[model samples]
Target chain A: MKRIKSKTAIVAIVFSLAGPLSAGESLPIRNCTWCHGSSAQGFSTAPRLAGQREKYIENQLLSFSAHIRDNPLSQQYMWGATANLSPEAMRDFAAYFSSLPPKAANDGDPQLAAQGRAIYELGIAEANVAACLVCHGPNAEGIREIPRLGGLSHAYLKRRLEQWGQGFHAAAEPMPQITRALSPNEIDALASYLSFVAYESLE
Target chain B: MKVIGLRLALPAAVLALVLSAPSRADEMGGPGFSSQELRAKLDYCKTCHGLSGQGYRGYFPMPRLAGQQPKYLENQLRAFYERRRSNPVMANVAHALSPSMVAALAAHFKDLNTNPIGGAPKEPVALGKTIYELGLPEANIPACSACHGPEAKGQGEIPRLAGQLFPYTVKTLGNWSKERGQGPAKDDTSFIMAATTHNLTQAQVAAIAAYVGSLR
Candidate 1:
């Protein structure tokens, strides 16, 4: 694990580089922090990069680098700009970022989140959706290639669902078919569930 | 806005055409993914991924790997094992499967019929459709179909959000945006999400998540 001081030093090293951005190594913090945050804690809009699985991070980096995972809003400047970077750098950066810890989510509407939690645990019958626990796990923890949803951003959640509704499926596995059936109200309940509910476990 | 929806599927259609590959070495046109283990996993995965592995709909997001290429499946499985793909939660699950098992799972998924995952009859579905057609425009949010495709299927860079499981979508989105040291989904995608999330609200998100999950 990287100590805060060490991470600072690494950033310092990157800052100290007098030449152009290195392709063989990770992208300088400058390019990364715009969305990830200066400390890589991520902001209200994004999830934490620290304390994440390294290989997962690497794959996503590769997706962006390869243009396999593109965001209409973000890709224009972030991923598209970094596509030229070497694979080694992508891995190194993924390793470095994955090693960091996540920033905790701030206080939200616990009751509303709890209301959302009910839907997460058990799906609405009229909607015909499965319980969130069926695939995500009982505690909102995710399954293989599936991510957990606790302590995330209200704003971010909103956009993603819109993306899903409108049909943005950057995720590799099953998401392509998943968003097809969602309705706006359901998106709201789920988002509330995530924003307000505290996940049972982080691991 | 209507024009945008009309154009939504162009990318996904093109993607399907591009990914349509010739048969690989020694293998027939089916189950062309990584390994046989994946085929076995396919049976196990059907509970959530659907019989065809296309997934039930927005709430499932399990992915429809039925005819995906071996290289892509192999790389994805390996990436999950090595933690080079998607998010930590998936990486953990992917890692649990043995190499051959992952390959077999991929193979199984690749062999399934993706048609089941195809477009549902054009009707009013719910959350996904509402959001897709009309974003929180006041929030300055963009409709997802603009890039993702009208049917919620995806193109190159974009994935198909339809039929994705509720948990996968919720969790992955959280992982990408919920700050550092939070949970398993951390990584660079977090950055991409930051800018995108700027246009949304929590309640809206919850509704959409459920809507997407409801796809049968």
Candidate 2:
């Protein structure tokens, strides 16, 4: 009788636990990490999704999926994974990745930081480009449609600007025209400035 | 007095109607969208363009793809890829992608739902209303709806104007004033945008930008 009761109780507990298991329960990782890196921070020239806004990340991936946004330079590499992301998977993926804290920006050169700051706060007097701060918010947290540029990795920022110049529309927004006006020097300066600038507020 | 009128009008409501309409004739659809749809999985082009391979409106000059057929979207996608299309920026986007990916993308957006995102904003949207109704006579800019339609829903080649990434919208207009190829559309009709912005002072640009941002 004791053995029978113990076996029944074990079966009951196991079945109860099993029922609660959900397909969505996975972290959306554990696979694809070899190239994407364990932290989802990206490897080589691929992007770092760690701590990114899930909506934004998903939006980018969707662009890849839908082809609204593409990078010929990087196309062959990403399509393999981006293809499998269904709309549902995209949302779950975005939500999963966006929920985590982002990695900190790399420590940068102080001298370059000051130069980049001046350029960021005040555009080249000759180019007529407005200060990024005027539109992006004083703290670079971004507002509405513009993106937060500060504290992002320099590599990411540089690549994004290069893509923008190359006509890679984020598609989620309309900046290709604006990006068309960005000179390589301006892009470099902006990327450098944006990388080291700290976000002064979260709100 | 004009400021007072802006304070009274419901621009956000009007903007929603303008943004959620169908895409243009030679194109696809409007800025049809919803935050809920986007948040779901990010895989839906229908979240804005419409299901059944239709396109919708967003920004200026971008048209609807719904019912237009994926073949056309594929062609445009090809144009974007090769630069046969005049859009240098869109070309870069197309170029970065593979033909297969482009086909899939065109298929999705062409098949996504056509709806506005979470209703439109509840903001007063006053400034946008002014710009929509009245021309910047000082700058010789015409009423927005003349080509764009009421509240900027758009018609023919004109595009839906609400619910866009406001920064991109503002930047495109501003860039059109500065760059040659980066106008409102794939075609040269973007001359309209260059003309409208021709006389705009920085303050006018900022005002219109704020108003437009308040929309969708």
> Ten-residue segment with the worst summed lDDT in candidate 2 chain A?
A122-131
Worst 10 residues of 1 chain B by lDDT: B21-30
Query: lDDT by residue for model 1 over B1-216, one digit each (tens)?
Result: 542443344344423432563342123223434423332334345545565566654324555555444555665555555554544444545645555555545554555445544333233347546876577677776786776567655554355555555555555555544532233544433355556655556555555555554443
Pick the TM-score winner: 1
Worst 10 residues of 2 chain B by lDDT: B36-45
lDDT of each: 0.54, 0.51
TM-score of each: 0.44, 0.43
Q: Which one is best on lDDT?
A: 1
What is candidate 1's lDDT per residue for A1-203, written digit by digit as tens? 54678778656754655456667654575577777676676675655565445666667677776766655655665576466777787777766766554544534454466656666765543233435666666655454345545555666665766675454544443443344445766666677667653533555
> How big is the positional error of residue A99 in model 1, measured in Å on the Cα after superposition?
2.9
